[model samples]
Every structure is written in structure tokens, then in C-alpha cells.
Target: MEKIATREAYGRALAALGEEQPALVVLDADLSKSTKTAIFQRKFPERFFNCGVAEQNMMGVAAGLAASGKIPFCSTFAVFATGRAFDQIRQSIAYPRLNVKIAASHAGITVGEDGASHQALEDLALMRALPGMTVLVPADAVETEKAVRAALEVDGPVYLRLGRAPVPVLHGPDFIFRLGEAVCLREGKDATIIATGIMVSQALEAAQMLADEGLDVRVLDMHTIKPLDVAAVVRAALETGAIVTAEEHSIIGGLGSAVAEALGEECPVPMKRVGIKDVFGESGRPEELLEKYGLTPYHLAEAVKEVLARKQAACR
Candidate 1:
């Protein structure tokens, strides 16, 4: 399987969308090369706006463009796109429900040596809190392209969480992406592993490991966090009897929290979340950071075992 960074996919998709949608415009905060929005800028130079390190101003400009009937895709690092322009995003774009797509790149601890300040472990939490905001975390290159296209079709504001590190292309060319829908990657009756973004592929790996131990593990790709697939969460809880959620973000307020919130109300089950345990990330290689932070497949497999154990103990 070929590996491609989600940011690279976003750039290519945006450039393709530009050729189709004349109303589509792009805004970047002086990180076009890193964010990969330079691809779109190169193809559609006239439609690209370089806001020069001012994320707040970029959000405002995107909102203005959206108001003028233009579909604006604001590009920047996830930390700056969400943290630096939170107020602007909430007030300017989300408040009015503008058609602005915040294509945030370099998300999660995968930003690597940039360290905690650059790593966006809480961007999903921030974006998900905004009313009418659509939060999407594509698992790989194929999903990233679909997400970029889907964001354009959606009505309101969209936040696309993209990664700096390359990940295996999990889905095939025929796979269709639907917003607020969870795709079941694997089936099992004993336990369910729900994961979003880069963790989806990791969950698949964990499923294989659990299978070797005679534990049947179901895998779910919960790519959309804001309009979470509550039905899938409830189904996994009721059918599998246990659930384990994995993400590259903090376990406190990310995909894990969203799944817990839905299941807590809909159908409570024995569950454990695999992610950063409420701690900031540090400078390191992406793979090393993932292992140190316990975001690896081994950790997810262990989480599955722990949840299943709790499930059995409760029955006993």
C-alpha cells in the first residue's frame, strides 16, 4: 500500500476542486508549502489568498469570501487554524454558518519534532464545540480526498484535521465517503474498536493482534467527530458488549470522549480509550512519539483486552 500524508491529499484534492468549482477560493497563512495548499495556489493563483501568518485575519477573510458567495478553504497548521483563530472562526464563520472549509494540516503529535506547541492535540475538541461546525478527520490519503470534496458539499463551516506524517492508504478507490457515517472496517462479536484519523489503521492492526489471541475484534472508522455516528456507537456497544476507542489526540476531549458521550446516553458499555493520557506531547520522531504516548497498535490491542475483561467481570 502506498503511503501519503493527509496534507498532500488535501492539496491535490483542493486543486482538483478548483478546476470544477469556479466559486472555490483558497486562503493560506504563509505556510502554503508545509500545509501543501501550494498545489491549489499553483493551479489557481488568482483564487489563492496569502494572509501572511495571520490566522485570525485569514479566518475573517475566509468568512468575508464566503459571505460574498465564494467557497473559501482556509489553510494552515491545525494549532494555528483552531487556537489562534478560535474567536474568529466561532464569530465570523460558524456564527453565520458560512461555507468556509478550514483545511488544517500538521495535526496531532505527528507534527513530530515541532513539539507540544505545534502539535494540535485539542483542535478537534475546540472545533467540535463550535455550534454548526462540521469536524472531519480523514484516516489516510484516499479518505482525505473524499473529505475535502465532502466539505465543499456540506452547507455550513467545516474543519478538516490533516496530518503531517504519511499513513498507509487504507481505503480503495471505490470506497465512498459519507459525512456522519461510520464505516465498519472489520467485524467481530466480542469487542469493537472505534477509531478516527490516523488511528483507524492502527485499530485495524490491533484487530489482527486480538484475533491471534482468539479475541474477535470489530473495527470502525469514525472519521467524522462533530456529527458523530451515534447509531454506530450504540450498535457497537450493544452488539459487541464492549468498546475501545483510539485516536492520535488527547483521550480527554477527542474521538474517545465523543464516543463515550454518545454511548453514555444511548447505551452504556464497558469501554477504554487509547490516546494521550491528558498530557502534552514532546519533540520526537512521529513513530517514537506514538509509542511513547501509547498511541500504538500494541496499546490499542491492550485496551481491547482490558475492556473485554471488564465486560466479562461485570457478567460474572
Candidate 2:
């Protein structure tokens, strides 16, 4: 029931990692306060660098630090981190496979009141497109902490997408975080809901709602966007026969697209994608934006029903 922002967890994780990993350095594009990297700056000032609103330059610096054998974590708003500094990220870090961690905060439409310009609806697609780039979208504070540590173990570039709003803590102390693996939150036979980021919690809620109507629904927390757990996706498609993917991003190339791609190649099935319908976000409260963009649990539940109907028709 407790709620905490993923950015807050990321900051705390960075500070924790700094104690154990001396080579770990943090760089921010003058937005540490918003990105929550200020926590690390406060703990280890010498290791933190403020790039002064230059996302591209920060990425370049991160690449340089990485080249020098230092694990550099670049923090900034998701929009600027991916959109403003894309070339630097691609050329400097991802192209050469530098060990730079780009922990982008305030991702997706949850960046309420910032409007479409600040919101990063396409960051996942951009990051996923990069070769050897590990993309992670943690479901909550717990997963964010684990994801930060996991990203450190990875040898190549990593894009850790985080949200601004506080979300329910989904994982417990016993939960283990593995890169490129999907966590099955709940088991069911009728259908499965694959979700990433904040939508994972919503998918669980929708699954519970469907249970009340005697519709069994499985739920998967697809935290890793790239190197997607195709095995789990294929298993879900083969067993459940239907799937509904939900995310706080565009339907084009996010969790939905990843699931669809896997299903198409391996096990084809009836599916529905619940996300922003090729539209931009607006300035409003986080909850309001979610409802307006049809990213709520109700929308996910409706999508489940629609997919279920399609699955039944396929059998007929």
C-alpha cells in the first residue's frame, strides 16, 4: 500500500551504489533535483557532475568517463535525455557499447503538468532500437532499486526509464530482479496482461477486477523492454491464448509493440494494446492524464474483455 516515486528510489540506489562502487560517477544536465540524482550529489559531491542543462554534453561526458573505466550514470528528464541527446547517446555510448547508465526520470505521460514537450512517450522505442542497449522500465520503487543495481552489472549501455509520480510498491524483499526476464505477478488460464512501468500495477488491478466476473487473467510485469523475455511471452500466448499489453507510452513501439513482435514470430494470438492512441499528452494531473489517455485499469480491463472476445471467435 505504500507509494514512492521511482526517481526517489533511483536516487537512493545511486547513493547506495556509490558506497560500494568507487568507480560509479553521476552526471546530471542541471536537473538533479527533478531527476533525484541530487541525493547522490549530496552524499558524494566529488563523484557527481552537473552538466548545466546540456543533455548531449552530459552524455558525451558520460561516454568519456565510461571510456576511462568509470561507471557513469547520466540523469535527466526523459524527454531531454532521449530526444535532446539522442545522437550523443547513439554515437558516443550505444554505438561503441560504452558502459554508461542513462537513468531517465519523469518518463511517459505521468509527467503531469509538464505537457507533451516534457513527457517522453517515445523514449522506449528510441532506446529499444539501439543495438546492445539494455532497456528497463521498473514497475515501482522496489523494482527501480533492483534495476539500478542490475544495470551496473551489465557491460553495455543501459536505459533505465523511471516515472515522476508515486506508485504502489509491487515487489517484496524476497523478489529477485533479473535482466531481460518477465515476472509473473499472478497466474490464470483465460488470458494474460503484459505490462511495463507504472502500467504493471494497473494490470494487476484489472486482473483482479476480471476475476470477480469469473474471468481468470494472468499478469506479467514486463520490466525489461529490450532483450524482451520472448520465452515468457510465447508461453503466455500458447497457454492463455490471448494477451493484452498496457503501458504509459505510445502503442507504436513500447511494451505493446514488443509483445506483438514476439507473438507474431513465435506464437500468434488474439491481443489488444492499451496505451496512448498515437496522441500526445497534455498538461494535467497525473491521474487525469492517465484517464484522458486511456491508460487506467478500467481501460486495461476493457481491453482484456475485447481480446477475450477475439480469442473466443478464433476458436469458433
Candidate 2, 1-316: lDDT as tens digits: 9999999999999999999999999999898898899999999999999999888999999999999999999999999999999999999999999999999999998899989999999999999999999999999999999999999999989999999999999999778999999999999999999999999999999999999999999999999999899999999999999999999999998889999999999999999988888988999999999998998989999999999999999989
| Model 2 per-residue lDDT at 214 | 99
Give the poorly placed runs of model 2, Cα more than 4 Å off.
none
RMSD (Å) per prediction: 0.7, 0.6
TM-score on alpha carbons, each prediction: 0.99, 0.99
The sequence of per-residue lDDT tens digits that candidate 1 reaches over residues 31-88 is 9999998998899999999999899999999999999999999999999999999999
Task: Tell how far residue 270 is off in model 1, in angstroms.
Answer: 0.3
All candidates' lDDT scores?
Answer: 0.93, 0.94
Instruction: Give the Cα error of residue 275 in candidate 2, in Å.
Output: 0.9
